[model samples]
Target chain A: MEVKLSLFGFGNVGKTVARVLLEKEAFFRERYGVEFKVVSIADTSGTVWLPEGIDLREALTVKETFGKLSAWTNDYEVYNFTPKEAVQEIDADIVIDVTNDKNAHEWHLTALRDEKAVVTSNKPPLAFHYAELREEAEKRNIPYLFEATVMAGTPIITLLRHGLRGDTVGRIEAVLNATTTFILSEMEKGLDFDDALKEAQKLGIAERDPSGDILGIDAGYKATILHCLAFEPITFDMASVKGIVEVTPGEIERAKAKGKTIRLVATIEEGRIVVGPKEIPKNSPLAVESHENVAVIKTDLLGKLVIKGAGAGLKETASGVVSDIVMAALMMR
Target chain B: MEVKLSLFGFGNVGKTVARVLLEKEAFFRERYGVEFKVVSIADTSGTVWLPEGIDLREALTVKETFGKLSAWTNDYEVYNFTPKEAVQEIDADIVIDVTNDKNAHEWHLTALRDEKAVVTSNKPPLAFHYAELREEAEKRNIPYLFEATVMAGTPIITLLRHGLRGDTVGRIEAVLNATTTFILSEMEKGLDFDDALKEAQKLGIAERDPSGDILGIDAGYKATILHCLAFEPITFDMASVKGIVEVTPGEIERAKAKGKTIRLVATIEEGRIVVGPKEIPKNSPLAVESHENVAVIKTDLLGKLVIKGAGAGLKETASGVVSDIVMAALMMR
Candidate 1:
């Protein structure tokens, strides 16, 4: 089946996805058996779409020079319209919801009601209204995948959702946030918190404002998602756990003396939410993990299933987005 | 659906599988929507099979006492046969193959040909003829999943098979053998190679002969499986890689003092087969992974799909067997 997609937001993830599709367009159809067309791209700059189709390379080069796609002046029509209305009328098999809109709740309700299966790198909807969204999806029998929203390209969400359907998991302990972990790791190496934060910012590991990542809010949202997926009713919010941006360099040094690392660990204990910075053994999966590496999940039957890899990056995050798209495609009727 | 299974080998992995089925009976059915039942078990001693299904707990107890099922002297007809034949005739929806009969490739061939989907913990047949078996499975459309065969219960097989299907991977680097890695880790900790090997043997991480795990043959088999899933044609064999098993404790100490660890690594470079020991930084994912933990594959697209966990444990291996059973049931048309 051919997929006509209207991609919203041409950020790092979106650009990488576009590039990957363009590079492997032929290979995917020939080897893996997938066909996709990114017909539209919309961002805050404005919307630029080709009804017939647009060349990925040309659009990419234009965006690089002009800073935003709206600057590209071609024969393509510029239907200055809100993204919500545009998505409904797009005539697409799927909609790539990569918008910067924080109100993911609105997107899910709107796009899903239109019978358009959504594949996103967004975190808000799953964090806020997992139950309602899942119920609606079941009723509609449509797939809503957010593999990038949690662990970038790690497939943590899919691992919990589909792969672990039959497994018995008592709890999941994860260092879901890579930015904070990276900052904390650098801080342990004698770099002050502010300097580490600056380094993380330069590396594009943290938010522009850095508030969501620094305040533990980002990791907290992931915990909520993980809790909902692994346990039940992801009412567990990050507010329950103390955020880590306030931790001083002195405190980090104190912890390091004992051969420990301050990691943002999210776990379910007796069906309750447990999220905080705990002292993990240096040789433990969590401590050894550097940069944006995420690890440490213990299940009832499988015991400890430890995984470490890139949690966030242009390439890694794009990998997650691609995974969601593929999964939604597979589940399509 | 009730899954009547005829379990063979009655070894660590086999016994662990039986335990998971008995304990997680309700969880499996309610969660996965499938019921599991073990009808017959075979060991060298004798056979204990209940046409109606015997008590798993009592059967295990009987096996422990006699070292075989024949010690019980039950009134029911005892059919002494290889698990291969038992699978063909026994009324079973799935066959659990956890036997260590490596050269007995015919056993795997017979089981799959009989229309009974196989879930194996053994790497023998898969290493020898993965393509042939996969072709047979394609013709039959039954899932012959061996997630445990590579990184026990880490979902590496699924990662390669389905998770990253849409992406084109350039290369894969892995520490596939747990026994060799364990011995090498201990050697780095000041123990000589002989002492480290002895410790591994005592912990049951190493076999009595220890050739397969020690001489890199175990990793070789796993690499072949990875090659089959990742590359085209899959022509490499155990003889291809420059195997590493004879490093001394002094070398391990030298590597460690320089803030690195020595790991016997198997890697695929630009579609070429490569395997050997190399020094890794202290914070590398593979360096931090110790004991029975296994980490493998740094794909070009999906960076470090590192799965670290109990590479080979009785229950973990058993859980994988049961997982394949549930999948086989789900795949039923």
Candidate 2:
């Protein structure tokens, strides 16, 4: 059976996902016996519908040259359809939500209720409305995979969900945000807080409006999602979040003098979620440098399972979304 | 659907698996919607058959007291059957081969031929005849899962096979054998090679015949299996094996003086598999300490994904086998 995919975002991640799907089309067919086609793609500007599967190469070129699907004058039909309307209208097997829209909760619900499996890199719906979406997906017997939500392409979600099934997880200590970690590493190198923030922004690692990252909201969101998945149901508001905005070079140096380093650590233990700058031993796993994200999951049976990788990137996150698509397809069979 | 599992070993790992299955019966049923039954169990002494599923609690009690199924004079009948005969006769959906019998290759083939899915911690069959067994399992449309063969319960196999499906894997640097790693770590603490081996043996970390581990043969076998699964098809002999038996404390101290640590590293790069004590930076992922295993997987899309966890333990290895059973059952549906 061919898997029909409808993408609800046309940003860098969405376009990179499309490129990977197109590039690995043959590999998927030959290895996994899965044939996938993107039938529709929608962005903020417009929506393009092609029930017979859009030509990925042409769509990529069109999107690269003209930043919106509405500008494409190909065999596809362009329309002014909202994400909700696109989900309701698109006849596909899966809906991929990569848009950074915080209010795509209803769109995801509609897709799940319509019997379309949902794969996403977006975190808002999962952070706020995980229980409802999970209940809907369970009721529909479809997958609601968001592997790219936390550590980009790293397989932490799947590892915890499926790989370590028999083990009881005790605690999770993680560095989930890349921007905050990068800033702190720079601070350790004698750069002041402002200079570190400027360097991060210059490297495109931090956005102009870095409130979500610097305020610990992003890591709190991930912690909330992880809590709902791994431990129990919890909302983002319940987490005790403290960001790296208050971390000064003097404090970093003080910790360094004591053989410790300050890192933005997200932790979930005993039903308490905390995301803040914590001073850890220099050799601790949480003291990872630069943009490297690490999660140390303490389990009863397997000890601690440490996974580290890139926390944020266009292709890295796209790889996770595509892998989820393949997994969803395989599970669908 | 109820999954019927047959055990071909009554050793520590196998008994621990039974205990875990009995313990997590409700969790598996409620969470994964999976109901599993142990239909048959066999050890070197005898075999016990139960088509309608044996009482796991009683079996555990009897095995704990008597050390073998043959001594259990309960409601079940005991018969003297070879592992091969047991696999051929047992009416099971899956056969779990956990026996340390290195010559149980024919029994695995028989199980596969009899249309039973195979889950194992045993490495001999895979280290020798991976392609043949894989071909047979594929021909029968059954899963031949051996996640416990490499890093016990740490999610390496599933991570490489399912999680990292979209990325192109480039290189793998790993510390796979815990005994050698433990010995090396002891040597790092100023013990000679002989004294370190004696310490490992006293701690039950190394066996009396520790040639397989000390000679790097164990790591070589794992490298072979990983190579076949990840990179390409290759036998154990194809790998360039170097043991840690010749690694002296002098060499370790020399490396330590240079800010490096001696670790028995198993590497697969450019289709070459090498297992030997190598001097790595003190903080490298491969420089894991006692009983801890680490794998650094380099991929094109995700950069390097590092995973570290317990490499060897009865419960840990059993956890991997049980997880594979659950995954196989889920896939069967």
Candidate number with greatest lDDT? 2
lDDT of each: 0.73, 0.89
Error of 1 at B2 (Å): 2.8
TM-score of 1: 0.88
Q: What is the alpha-carbon lDDT of model 1 when measured against the actual structure? A: 0.73
Please give the RMSD of candidate 1 to the true structure. 3.4
Count the clashes in each prediction.
Answer: 0, 0
> Which residue pairs clash in candidate 1?
none
Chain B TM-score for the candidates in order: 0.92, 0.97
Candidate 2's TM-score: 0.94
Show the lowest summed lDDT stretch of 10 residues, model 2 chain A: A68-77
Per-residue alpha-carbon lDDT of candidate 2 for residues B1-333, written as tens digits (9 for 90 to 100): 799999888888888999899888898898788899999988888998999998988888888898878888759899888888888888998999998888777888898888888998999899889888999988988888998999999989889877877777889999999999889889989899999999999999999989999999999999888888777677888899999989987899999999999888999976799999899998888888878889999987888899999899988898899989998888677
Q: In candidate 2, which residue ranges exceed 4 Å CA deviation?
A: A74-76, B33-35
Worst ten-residue run, lDDT, model 2 chain B? Answer: B228-237
